[model samples]
Target: MSSFAKPGSEEQELKWAWIWFKQFCAFHRRAVEREREFSADEVIAFLRSKRDANVPAWKRMKVIEGLIVFRESVQHRNPADLLPLRETMRGIVSIERAKSEGYDTIDDVVGKIDPKEPDAIQEFRRALRRGGMALRTERTYVGKLKNFMADRGLTCLADFERIGAADVEAHLTDLAVDGNVAPSTQNVSFHSLLKFFTLVLKREMGKIEAIRATKKPMTPTVLGPKEIAGVFEGLSGVHLTIAKL
Candidate 1:
């Protein structure tokens, strides 16, 4: 019997598998040409465009999900290159709309953007200082905020206005769960988000507790004598003159 006629046959399974594999390969190649890495924004934009171009929504959604997973793996290994690719993909997607069909490439995309839009990072930094965050705290918070934005495929910190309490919670949860950060570290992230929303975005965060309050077991204390001995042993080359201090 033919493969299509046998529902449980190995040949039938192989045929379906090959079909899916070919589809994935085709989408992957297209994504590669669009940019070196994929991001959530890029996936959404691509799916929207595909839908606009008459592709089925289900197919586009599946392809976008696969692309995101593949791109995230690449990002984990090489984050430095991933950011630019994400920006590039956003530009590409933006320029492909019906109103801007003639535009292509990063230069074209960036060139058309208005120069008057305020720089989000600089603005947020200014806001942070105005909100009385210490210089060191400002730097640390901005770094965390920037990384968070990048992870979520946001182009700027100003985009925090669009983010809700749930999004903030989810990000903090991921940092705790996936990042395996200490409670203190997670609390810092929580404060950073709270500040970004309340101070920079001038919005309120309602009833969200700081992640730091969730304490883990205390780290075991090292015996001081053993620590002192280890340090002293490492000073073997030094001439220790017995000086009465």
Candidate 2:
């Protein structure tokens, strides 16, 4: 676990960090010809972009830790190259705190966004990007939020602030009961909305406790050697010719 990391936080950090590293890889792929090396300068630029986009400071730090760990453990490269990014982020974080603008995830946010998000769900997209999530993630999350908003009638001129945990639970529950989505699909939808509400919409998720989608038991298809041979023996005439051909 990382220093000062809460219990189980390191796992969460790695999860979130992988999310960031993917972005780093994407950025690295775009800006350089050879993808053989992880550059601290490139990472610094990526972190700067995240800060500019208003990703929380703690989240960006996790991103750096992920890169460091990746270099040391996965890539078997020197982790020291990323130290500059850590120091640079430290100074920036200090400046943010001195200005009294450091926003903690635990702190309650008291404002709402344009609930409609009529401009192509840009706000949600921005939130995902700022969080250093990947482009595919942005697409999936945006799709999920759009479906949730449209289904729940948040399109236009509706009371969005009143949208709460009950509404979310109802939507997910409907997907399970009515839509008959697989358990994993329902989980994806749940998390998509969870992040949207908590990170993008700045609302508390409270507790999910929604009725989960139960996966039905599946039967395996198998044929014994005798069964296969009998089937082959039965294949005469055109079937046999087609099989041979």
Candidate 3:
């Protein structure tokens, strides 16, 4: 029934975090009505929802830090579990600051991408530009995220809040078992999803315990007779003598 966080300083922005959390609960959830208590999953979902809504990373960091402080001083729970989230938030802030690093942003992202894309996708591209990642990598990440959304019937990024580690595992497992994708392909999809969740969604993915893709057999790398002959064809004089020796 109680809906108030303890008084906190403006310097830390803990006050604003409480305000945001309450508003988030009222709008998206009934946690406030239930107990004003939220689990790590809910918090992750909330932060991701904020990212989906185009909320700045600094504000999300404030919520995370404030929640940690609240746990320590208010609920007296261990805040160790949230430390990784803090690190992730720091990376987000760093990425936002990286726009001025002088890598090509005018065309690499702002011009090449459709302006009609979702804000989350647009932000994902901006993050890639600031990170200086290859264009191939950006496309791969976006494609993988789209596949996940398709599988889940997710129409917009805002619904990404419902996705978590379980969904990630399920999708990868289906790709391996049902779709029968190659091991390397599934592996790329796995990394692509992980990076998207961590960097774009602003959430930490838990350990994946899904069935793995089968590895394909490979031929040995020893030089063939033709290749050996070709190599000797280019050698001459002292080099040929040394090769013969």
Choose the strongest candidate by TM-score: 2
Please tell me which model should have the higher lDDT, number 2 or number 3. 3
Candidate 2 runs further than 4 Å off: 1-120, 156-159, 217-220, 237-245
Quality of model 1 by C-alpha lDDT: 0.56
TM-score against truth, every candidate: 0.39, 0.49, 0.45
Off by over 4 Å in 1: 1-118, 209-245
Q: Which candidate is the best by lDDT?
A: 3
Between candidates 2 and 3, name the one with more favorable TM-score.
2
- Residue range 1-245, candidate 1, lDDT tens digits: 63355556545544443443345546445532323444445445545566678764445544543444344443333334335544554444443441243434434322333345335656666676445444567678878777678767787655666778777777787777777777778777778877777766777876654243354767997658777666566564333322111
Better of 1 and 2 by lDDT: 2
lDDT of 3 at 226: 91
lDDT of predicted model 2: 0.71
Candidate 3: tens digits of C-alpha lDDT, residues 190-233:
88888878777888988898788885757788988999888889
Model 2: per-residue lDDT, tens digit, 150-173? 888786324457788888899898
Against the true structure, candidate 3 reaches a TM-score of 0.45
